[model samples]
Target: MARLEVRQSWLGDVLGLSQSVVSKRLRGLLPFTGPELLLIASAMNISLGELLGGIVNEKNPHPVDGGSSGVAGGRLDLPTSRL
Candidate 1:
Protein backbone atom coordinates (compact mmCIF):
# COMPACT_ATOMS: atom_id res chain seq x y z
CA MET A 1 0.00 0.00 0.00
CA ALA A 2 2.91 2.33 0.68
CA ARG A 3 4.00 1.92 -2.91
CA LEU A 4 0.48 2.81 -3.92
CA GLU A 5 0.70 5.90 -1.69
CA VAL A 6 -1.74 4.61 0.85
CA ARG A 7 -1.45 6.07 4.30
CA GLN A 8 -0.66 3.73 7.17
CA SER A 9 -3.08 5.56 9.44
CA TRP A 10 -5.86 5.12 6.90
CA LEU A 11 -5.20 1.42 6.66
CA GLY A 12 -5.23 1.13 10.44
CA ASP A 13 -8.52 2.97 10.55
CA VAL A 14 -9.98 0.64 7.95
CA LEU A 15 -8.86 -2.43 9.87
CA GLY A 16 -10.07 -0.99 13.19
CA LEU A 17 -6.65 -1.58 14.67
CA SER A 18 -4.12 0.77 16.15
CA GLN A 19 -1.23 1.99 14.08
CA SER A 20 1.12 0.12 16.41
CA VAL A 21 -0.87 -3.07 15.93
CA VAL A 22 -0.72 -2.69 12.17
CA SER A 23 3.00 -2.08 12.41
CA LYS A 24 3.39 -5.23 14.47
CA ARG A 25 1.52 -7.19 11.81
CA LEU A 26 3.68 -5.69 9.08
CA ARG A 27 6.74 -6.69 11.09
CA GLY A 28 5.30 -10.23 11.42
CA LEU A 29 5.15 -10.03 15.20
CA LEU A 30 1.38 -10.54 15.16
CA PRO A 31 -1.09 -12.03 12.74
CA PHE A 32 -4.14 -10.20 11.45
CA THR A 33 -7.53 -11.36 12.67
CA GLY A 34 -10.02 -12.84 10.19
CA PRO A 35 -12.20 -9.76 10.16
CA GLU A 36 -9.21 -7.49 9.86
CA LEU A 37 -7.95 -9.42 6.84
CA LEU A 38 -11.33 -9.12 5.22
CA LEU A 39 -11.33 -5.39 5.88
CA ILE A 40 -7.88 -5.10 4.36
CA ALA A 41 -9.07 -6.94 1.29
CA SER A 42 -11.95 -4.55 0.98
CA ALA A 43 -9.66 -1.57 1.34
CA MET A 44 -7.42 -2.95 -1.39
CA ASN A 45 -10.40 -3.62 -3.65
CA ILE A 46 -9.72 -7.36 -3.66
CA SER A 47 -11.68 -10.37 -2.51
CA LEU A 48 -10.78 -11.95 0.81
CA GLY A 49 -10.01 -15.24 -0.93
CA GLU A 50 -7.54 -13.55 -3.27
CA LEU A 51 -6.07 -11.50 -0.43
CA LEU A 52 -5.05 -14.59 1.51
CA GLY A 53 -5.14 -17.29 -1.16
CA GLY A 54 -1.50 -18.36 -1.11
CA ILE A 55 -0.62 -16.84 2.25
CA VAL A 56 -3.14 -18.91 4.17
CA ASN A 57 -5.50 -21.81 3.65
CA GLU A 58 -8.82 -20.52 2.35
CA LYS A 59 -10.75 -23.74 3.11
CA ASN A 60 -9.71 -23.65 6.77
CA PRO A 61 -8.17 -20.48 8.06
CA HIS A 62 -7.21 -21.84 11.43
CA PRO A 63 -4.81 -24.57 10.44
CA VAL A 64 -4.13 -27.56 12.64
CA ASP A 65 -1.38 -27.23 15.21
CA GLY A 66 0.04 -30.63 14.28
CA GLY A 67 1.05 -31.17 17.94
CA SER A 68 3.72 -28.47 17.93
CA SER A 69 3.52 -26.20 20.93
CA GLY A 70 4.76 -22.65 21.30
CA VAL A 71 5.06 -19.74 23.68
CA ALA A 72 2.08 -17.86 25.08
CA GLY A 73 -0.50 -16.23 22.79
CA GLY A 74 0.61 -18.14 19.66
CA ARG A 75 3.99 -16.48 19.52
CA LEU A 76 6.80 -18.85 18.68
CA ASP A 77 9.66 -19.33 21.17
CA LEU A 78 12.43 -17.55 19.35
CA PRO A 79 15.00 -17.10 22.10
CA THR A 80 17.97 -19.47 22.17
CA SER A 81 17.23 -22.42 24.42
CA ARG A 82 19.72 -23.89 26.82
CA LEU A 83 20.45 -27.53 26.14
Candidate 2:
Protein backbone atom coordinates (compact mmCIF):
# COMPACT_ATOMS: atom_id res chain seq x y z
CA MET A 1 0.00 0.00 0.00
CA ALA A 2 2.85 2.32 0.81
CA ARG A 3 4.20 1.80 -2.67
CA LEU A 4 0.86 2.78 -4.12
CA GLU A 5 0.15 5.43 -1.55
CA VAL A 6 -3.08 3.64 -0.76
CA ARG A 7 -4.33 4.30 2.75
CA GLN A 8 -6.15 1.69 4.77
CA SER A 9 -9.40 3.62 4.69
CA TRP A 10 -9.25 3.91 0.92
CA LEU A 11 -8.49 0.22 0.47
CA GLY A 12 -11.27 -0.63 2.88
CA ASP A 13 -13.64 1.55 0.90
CA VAL A 14 -12.60 -0.11 -2.34
CA LEU A 15 -13.05 -3.59 -0.87
CA GLY A 16 -16.33 -2.70 0.79
CA LEU A 17 -14.76 -3.53 4.15
CA SER A 18 -13.93 -1.47 7.20
CA GLN A 19 -10.45 -0.18 7.81
CA SER A 20 -10.07 -2.44 10.84
CA VAL A 21 -10.87 -5.49 8.74
CA VAL A 22 -8.31 -4.47 6.16
CA SER A 23 -5.83 -3.75 8.95
CA LYS A 24 -6.37 -7.16 10.49
CA ARG A 25 -5.69 -8.82 7.16
CA LEU A 26 -2.62 -6.69 6.55
CA ARG A 27 -1.29 -7.53 10.00
CA GLY A 28 -1.98 -11.22 9.51
CA LEU A 29 -4.57 -11.26 12.26
CA LEU A 30 -7.12 -12.31 9.65
CA PRO A 31 -6.73 -14.01 6.32
CA PHE A 32 -7.74 -12.21 3.12
CA THR A 33 -10.40 -14.15 1.26
CA GLY A 34 -9.75 -15.21 -2.31
CA PRO A 35 -12.20 -12.66 -3.60
CA GLU A 36 -10.66 -9.93 -1.49
CA LEU A 37 -7.21 -10.85 -2.73
CA LEU A 38 -8.47 -10.80 -6.29
CA LEU A 39 -10.03 -7.42 -5.77
CA ILE A 40 -6.86 -6.02 -4.29
CA ALA A 41 -4.78 -7.51 -7.08
CA SER A 42 -7.08 -6.05 -9.70
CA ALA A 43 -7.10 -2.68 -8.00
CA MET A 44 -3.33 -2.73 -7.89
CA ASN A 45 -3.12 -3.76 -11.56
CA ILE A 46 -1.07 -6.81 -10.62
CA SER A 47 -1.41 -10.53 -11.08
CA LEU A 48 -2.66 -12.87 -8.34
CA GLY A 49 0.74 -14.55 -8.28
CA GLU A 50 2.44 -11.24 -7.50
CA LEU A 51 -0.12 -10.54 -4.81
CA LEU A 52 0.65 -13.91 -3.21
CA GLY A 53 4.37 -13.76 -3.77
CA GLY A 54 5.12 -14.63 -0.17
CA ILE A 55 3.47 -18.03 -0.51
CA VAL A 56 6.08 -19.27 -2.97
CA ASN A 57 8.60 -21.94 -2.01
CA GLU A 58 11.98 -20.24 -1.81
CA LYS A 59 13.87 -23.52 -2.30
CA ASN A 60 12.09 -24.18 -5.57
CA PRO A 61 11.00 -20.80 -6.86
CA HIS A 62 9.73 -22.13 -10.18
CA PRO A 63 6.60 -24.21 -10.38
CA VAL A 64 6.98 -27.99 -10.12
CA ASP A 65 5.25 -28.44 -13.51
CA GLY A 66 3.40 -31.64 -12.72
CA GLY A 67 1.76 -33.43 -15.70
CA SER A 68 -1.40 -32.09 -17.19
CA SER A 69 -4.43 -32.46 -14.89
CA GLY A 70 -1.99 -32.90 -11.96
CA VAL A 71 -1.21 -30.55 -9.11
CA ALA A 72 2.14 -28.79 -8.96
CA GLY A 73 3.06 -28.58 -5.33
CA GLY A 74 -0.11 -27.02 -3.98
CA ARG A 75 -0.86 -24.91 -7.05
CA LEU A 76 -2.68 -26.05 -10.14
CA ASP A 77 -1.26 -25.76 -13.63
CA LEU A 78 -3.28 -22.76 -14.67
CA PRO A 79 -2.84 -20.23 -17.43
CA THR A 80 -1.26 -16.84 -16.70
CA SER A 81 -3.86 -14.82 -18.49
CA ARG A 82 -4.79 -11.61 -16.74
CA LEU A 83 -8.07 -11.63 -14.94
Candidate 3:
Protein backbone atom coordinates (compact mmCIF):
# COMPACT_ATOMS: atom_id res chain seq x y z
CA MET A 1 0.00 0.00 0.00
CA ALA A 2 2.82 2.34 0.84
CA ARG A 3 4.44 1.51 -2.46
CA LEU A 4 1.22 2.16 -4.31
CA GLU A 5 0.69 5.43 -2.50
CA VAL A 6 4.20 6.51 -3.30
CA ARG A 7 3.69 5.61 -6.92
CA GLN A 8 0.56 7.70 -6.98
CA SER A 9 2.31 10.59 -5.23
CA TRP A 10 -0.11 10.29 -2.34
CA LEU A 11 2.41 9.35 0.34
CA GLY A 12 2.60 11.91 3.10
CA ASP A 13 4.36 12.41 6.38
CA VAL A 14 3.21 9.72 8.79
CA LEU A 15 1.34 11.19 11.72
CA GLY A 16 1.50 10.14 15.39
CA LEU A 17 4.49 7.86 14.89
CA SER A 18 8.21 8.31 14.95
CA GLN A 19 10.47 7.15 12.14
CA SER A 20 11.77 4.26 14.23
CA VAL A 21 8.26 3.15 15.16
CA VAL A 22 7.13 3.35 11.55
CA SER A 23 10.16 1.41 10.41
CA LYS A 24 9.67 -1.29 13.03
CA ARG A 25 5.98 -1.59 12.30
CA LEU A 26 6.55 -1.73 8.55
CA ARG A 27 9.28 -4.29 8.94
CA GLY A 28 6.95 -6.64 10.85
CA LEU A 29 8.83 -6.18 14.09
CA LEU A 30 5.99 -4.44 15.91
CA PRO A 31 2.27 -4.96 16.33
CA PHE A 32 -0.51 -2.44 15.59
CA THR A 33 -3.90 -2.19 17.22
CA GLY A 34 -7.31 -2.16 15.52
CA PRO A 35 -7.59 1.62 15.62
CA GLU A 36 -4.05 2.00 14.41
CA LEU A 37 -4.81 -0.34 11.54
CA LEU A 38 -7.77 1.80 10.62
CA LEU A 39 -5.64 4.93 10.71
CA ILE A 40 -3.05 3.38 8.46
CA ALA A 41 -5.69 2.17 6.01
CA SER A 42 -7.32 5.58 5.96
CA ALA A 43 -4.00 7.25 5.34
CA MET A 44 -3.30 4.93 2.44
CA ASN A 45 -6.73 5.14 0.84
CA ILE A 46 -7.44 1.43 0.89
CA SER A 47 -9.63 -1.10 2.65
CA LEU A 48 -8.57 -2.77 5.88
CA GLY A 49 -8.87 -6.16 4.23
CA GLU A 50 -6.62 -5.02 1.42
CA LEU A 51 -4.14 -3.77 3.94
CA LEU A 52 -4.28 -6.97 6.03
CA GLY A 53 -4.32 -9.13 2.88
CA GLY A 54 -3.42 -12.76 3.69
CA ILE A 55 -4.65 -12.54 7.27
CA VAL A 56 -8.18 -11.85 6.08
CA ASN A 57 -10.44 -14.47 4.49
CA GLU A 58 -11.30 -12.39 1.44
CA LYS A 59 -13.46 -15.18 0.00
CA ASN A 60 -16.01 -14.86 2.78
CA PRO A 61 -16.26 -11.45 4.38
CA HIS A 62 -18.40 -8.39 4.93
CA PRO A 63 -17.86 -5.27 2.84
CA VAL A 64 -16.83 -1.96 4.30
CA ASP A 65 -17.92 1.44 3.01
CA GLY A 66 -18.00 5.17 3.83
CA GLY A 67 -14.24 5.46 4.02
CA SER A 68 -12.27 8.54 3.04
CA SER A 69 -10.08 8.43 0.00
CA GLY A 70 -8.50 11.77 0.69
CA VAL A 71 -5.77 12.87 3.08
CA ALA A 72 -8.17 13.82 5.83
CA GLY A 73 -10.53 12.41 8.43
CA GLY A 74 -11.86 9.07 7.22
CA ARG A 75 -13.62 6.17 8.89
CA LEU A 76 -11.39 3.20 9.37
CA ASP A 77 -12.79 -0.22 10.31
CA LEU A 78 -9.90 -2.48 11.18
CA PRO A 79 -10.28 -6.18 10.72
CA THR A 80 -10.07 -8.49 13.72
CA SER A 81 -7.06 -10.55 12.75
CA ARG A 82 -4.38 -12.16 14.87
CA LEU A 83 -1.39 -11.05 12.89
Candidate 4:
Protein backbone atom coordinates (compact mmCIF):
# COMPACT_ATOMS: atom_id res chain seq x y z
CA MET A 1 0.00 0.00 0.00
CA ALA A 2 2.93 2.28 0.63
CA ARG A 3 4.09 1.62 -2.89
CA LEU A 4 0.66 2.48 -4.19
CA GLU A 5 0.67 5.67 -2.19
CA VAL A 6 4.17 6.74 -3.17
CA ARG A 7 4.25 5.49 -6.74
CA GLN A 8 0.64 5.81 -7.86
CA SER A 9 -0.50 8.50 -5.48
CA TRP A 10 -3.44 6.33 -4.49
CA LEU A 11 -4.90 6.22 -1.05
CA GLY A 12 -6.30 3.03 0.41
CA ASP A 13 -9.80 4.39 0.32
CA VAL A 14 -9.45 5.08 -3.39
CA LEU A 15 -9.06 1.35 -3.96
CA GLY A 16 -12.09 0.58 -1.81
CA LEU A 17 -9.95 -1.22 0.71
CA SER A 18 -8.48 -0.39 4.05
CA GLN A 19 -4.76 -0.08 4.60
CA SER A 20 -4.73 -3.21 6.78
CA VAL A 21 -6.74 -5.18 4.25
CA VAL A 22 -4.40 -4.19 1.45
CA SER A 23 -1.44 -5.03 3.62
CA LYS A 24 -2.84 -8.46 4.39
CA ARG A 25 -3.43 -9.15 0.73
CA LEU A 26 0.14 -8.23 -0.04
CA ARG A 27 1.33 -10.98 2.23
CA GLY A 28 0.65 -13.31 -0.73
CA LEU A 29 -0.70 -16.06 1.50
CA LEU A 30 -3.59 -16.61 -0.89
CA PRO A 31 -3.67 -16.99 -4.63
CA PHE A 32 -4.73 -14.03 -6.72
CA THR A 33 -6.44 -14.16 -10.09
CA GLY A 34 -5.30 -12.30 -13.15
CA PRO A 35 -7.70 -9.43 -12.69
CA GLU A 36 -6.96 -9.11 -9.01
CA LEU A 37 -3.31 -8.98 -9.90
CA LEU A 38 -4.13 -6.47 -12.57
CA LEU A 39 -6.04 -4.27 -10.13
CA ILE A 40 -3.19 -4.35 -7.65
CA ALA A 41 -0.64 -3.74 -10.35
CA SER A 42 -2.63 -0.87 -11.77
CA ALA A 43 -3.18 0.53 -8.32
CA MET A 44 0.51 0.36 -7.67
CA ASN A 45 1.41 1.48 -11.17
CA ILE A 46 3.66 -1.50 -11.56
CA SER A 47 3.92 -4.55 -13.76
CA LEU A 48 2.46 -7.94 -12.82
CA GLY A 49 5.94 -9.35 -12.94
CA GLU A 50 6.96 -6.84 -10.33
CA LEU A 51 3.84 -7.50 -8.29
CA LEU A 52 4.66 -11.19 -8.25
CA GLY A 53 8.08 -10.22 -7.03
CA GLY A 54 9.88 -11.48 -10.12
CA ILE A 55 8.21 -14.88 -9.96
CA VAL A 56 8.25 -15.37 -13.72
CA ASN A 57 7.95 -19.15 -13.47
CA GLU A 58 4.61 -18.93 -11.71
CA LYS A 59 3.08 -16.29 -13.91
CA ASN A 60 -0.25 -17.16 -15.52
CA PRO A 61 -0.65 -20.28 -13.45
CA HIS A 62 -4.40 -20.05 -13.27
CA PRO A 63 -7.29 -19.01 -15.52
CA VAL A 64 -9.23 -16.16 -13.95
CA ASP A 65 -13.01 -16.51 -14.27
CA GLY A 66 -15.11 -16.21 -11.12
CA GLY A 67 -15.01 -17.82 -7.75
CA SER A 68 -14.89 -17.05 -4.07
CA SER A 69 -12.44 -18.53 -1.64
CA GLY A 70 -12.17 -18.19 2.09
CA VAL A 71 -9.83 -15.51 3.19
CA ALA A 72 -9.06 -13.69 6.43
CA GLY A 73 -12.08 -11.43 6.82
CA GLY A 74 -14.32 -13.21 4.30
CA ARG A 75 -14.45 -14.82 0.91
CA LEU A 76 -12.75 -12.85 -1.78
CA ASP A 77 -14.01 -13.07 -5.34
CA LEU A 78 -11.37 -14.18 -7.73
CA PRO A 79 -10.87 -11.67 -10.47
CA THR A 80 -10.89 -12.35 -14.18
CA SER A 81 -8.59 -10.90 -16.73
CA ARG A 82 -9.39 -7.34 -17.77
CA LEU A 83 -6.69 -7.33 -20.39
Using TM-score, give the best candidate's number: 2
The digit string of per-residue lDDT tens for model 3 on 1-68 reads 43452321222254566656545555445555556667667887888778766544555243223222
TM-score of 1: 0.57
| Runs of candidate 2 exceeding 4 Å displacement | 58-83
How much is the lDDT of residue 21 in candidate 3? 58
What are the TM-scores, per candidate, against the unseen true structure?
Answer: 0.57, 0.63, 0.53, 0.43
**lDDT (0-100) at residue 46 of candidate 1?**
79
Query: How would you order the candidates by TM-score, starting with the best?
Result: 2, 1, 3, 4
Q: Rank the candidates by lDDT, best first.
A: 2, 1, 3, 4
Comparing 1 and 4 on TM-score, the stronger one: 1
Misplaced by over 4 Å in model 1 are: 57-83
- The residue-by-residue lDDT of candidate 4 on 15-82, one tens digit each, is 56565654455454444445555676676677765655534345433233321332222223322122
Enumerate clash totals for all models, in the order shown.
0, 0, 0, 0
Candidate number that wins on lDDT, 1 or 4: 1
TM-score of 3: 0.53
TM-score between model 2 and native: 0.63
Each model's lDDT: 0.53, 0.59, 0.47, 0.44
State the lDDT of candidate 1 residue by residue for 9-65, as single tens digits. Answer: 677788777878766665558755555665777888877556555444555454224
In model 2, how large is the Cα lDDT of residue 20?
88
Ten residues in sequence with the least summed lDDT for candidate 1: 74-83
